[model samples]
Target: MNEEQLFKQISLVRQATLKQLESVTEAQADEQPEGFRNTIRWNIGHIYVVQNSLLAKFGGKPVATPSRYIELFAPGTKPADWEGDIPSLDELKQELEEQPLKLKEVLSGQLDDEAAQPFLSLPTVGEILNFTIYHEGVHTGTVKALKDKAAK
Candidate 1:
C-alpha cells in the first residue's frame, strides 16, 4: 500500500497495543504468562526496535541501535549477557507515537518505492509493514495474557 496507509496501519496496531498496556504495572510487564509469554514491556520495545531498524535500513539516518540493545535484539545477535536498564514502557509508547509521524514525513511519496525492494525474508517494505500488522497482534495477545497472569 501507500505510505499514508502504512502509517495508518502502524498507528492502529500501536494504539491498540498501547491500549492493552494501559494501567499495566511494571510488575505485570515483567511477569511471564503461560502460552503467552514475555514481559509486555519487552515485547513493546522489541517491536519498536524492529521498526526503527526497518526504517533505518530504508533511509540510514538513525545509525545503529545503542550498543546494549544491539546485542540483545539485533538480527542473529541474541543477548549473551546483557545487564542494563532499558527504556520504560511509557518511553517506548511515546516513541511509538512520535517516531511514526517523523517517518511518515520523511517517507512521504516513498513508502511504496522503499517497501517495494527486497529486504530480510520478505521482499519490499510493504511486505514488512504487512507482517508488522500481524506481528503486533500476536504480541498484543501475549501481552494481554501476561497481564492476566500478573493479576493472579
Candidate 2:
C-alpha cells in the first residue's frame, strides 16, 4: 500500500488497541492470567516498542520508545521478571494514542526505501511497517483475551 494508506491503517489499528483497553485499570493491566506469559500492560507496551523498533531497524527511522520499554516489553521478556518502575496503563494508553502521528511524521514518503536488511523476506520499509500491523493485532488479541480472563 501507499504511504497515506499505511498510515491510515496504523492509526486505525492503534485506535482499536486503545479502545480495547478503555476499561482496563492499572491493576487489571498488571494481572497475568493462567496460561498467559504476559499481562495486558506488557502487551500494550510491547506493541509500542515493537512498532518503533521495526520502524527504526527496517524503515530507517530513529527509535521513539524509551530505553526502559525495551527492557520491560521486548520479546522474550515477561511480567514475572519485570522490575523497576513500570509505566501505568494510562501512560501506555497515551503513548499508543500518539504513536501513529509520530510514525506518519517520521516515515512519510519513505515507505518505498530499502530496508536496512530483509525481515522475513520483506525488503522494503513499507512492507516491514505492514508487518507491524499484524504484530499489533496479535498482541491486541492477547490483550482482549487477558481482559476477558481478568473480568472472570
Candidate 3:
C-alpha cells in the first residue's frame, strides 16, 4: 500500500488505541498486572516513542518528541526502572492523538525516499513507516490486554 493509505490505517489504529485508554484511570494505568512486564502507562508511552524513534531518528527526519520520552520508554527501559515524573495517561493520549498528523507533515511526499539506514529489512521510508504502524498495533494490543488485566 501507498503512504496515504498507510497513514490512514495508522490514524485508525491510533484512534482505537486511544479509545481503549479512555476508561483506564491513572492508578489502573500504573498497574503491572501479573505476567505483564510493564504497565499500561508504559506501553502507551512506548507506542508514542517507538514510531518517532524509528521514523524520525532512524529515517533522519525531524519529529519533535521530548527527549525524556525516549529515555523513559525506549525498548530496554521499563516503568520499574523509571526514576521520576512519568507522563500521565491523558498527556500520553494527547501526544498519541497528534502523532499521526505530525508524522504526515514530516513525511509527506517522502515515502519513496530510502531510509538513511535500513531498520531490519525495511529499506525505504514507506517500508519503515509500514513497519512502525505494525509495531504500534502490536503495542496497542498489549495495551488492551494490560488494561483488561489491570482493571480486574
Q: Best-fitting candidate, measured by TM-score?
A: 2
TM-score against native, each model: 0.76, 0.97, 0.96
Model 2, span 1-152: residue lDDT tens: 77888899989999999999988888899888889989999999999999999878766777577999999999999888978899988889999998999888887888888998888899998999999999999999999999889878
Model 3 over residues 25-78: C-alpha lDDT tens digits? 998888887798988898889999998888876687777779999999999888
Arranged by TM-score, best first: 2, 3, 1
lDDT of each: 0.65, 0.90, 0.87
Candidate 1 per-residue lDDT over residues 1-152, each given as its tens digit: 66667789878887888898888877666665655435676677676677667656743334245555554555443223336776676777787677667656665665445443355667555566567678768878877777777778
lDDT, candidate 3, at 102: 90
> Backbone clash tally for model 1?
1
Instruction: Give lDDT for model 1.
Output: 0.65
Indicate whether candidate 1 or candidate 3 has the larger lDDT.
3
| Predictions: Cα RMSD each | 3.2, 0.9, 1.0
Task: List the candidate 3 regions with Cα displacement exceeding 4 Å.
Answer: none
lDDT score for candidate 2 against the true structure: 0.90
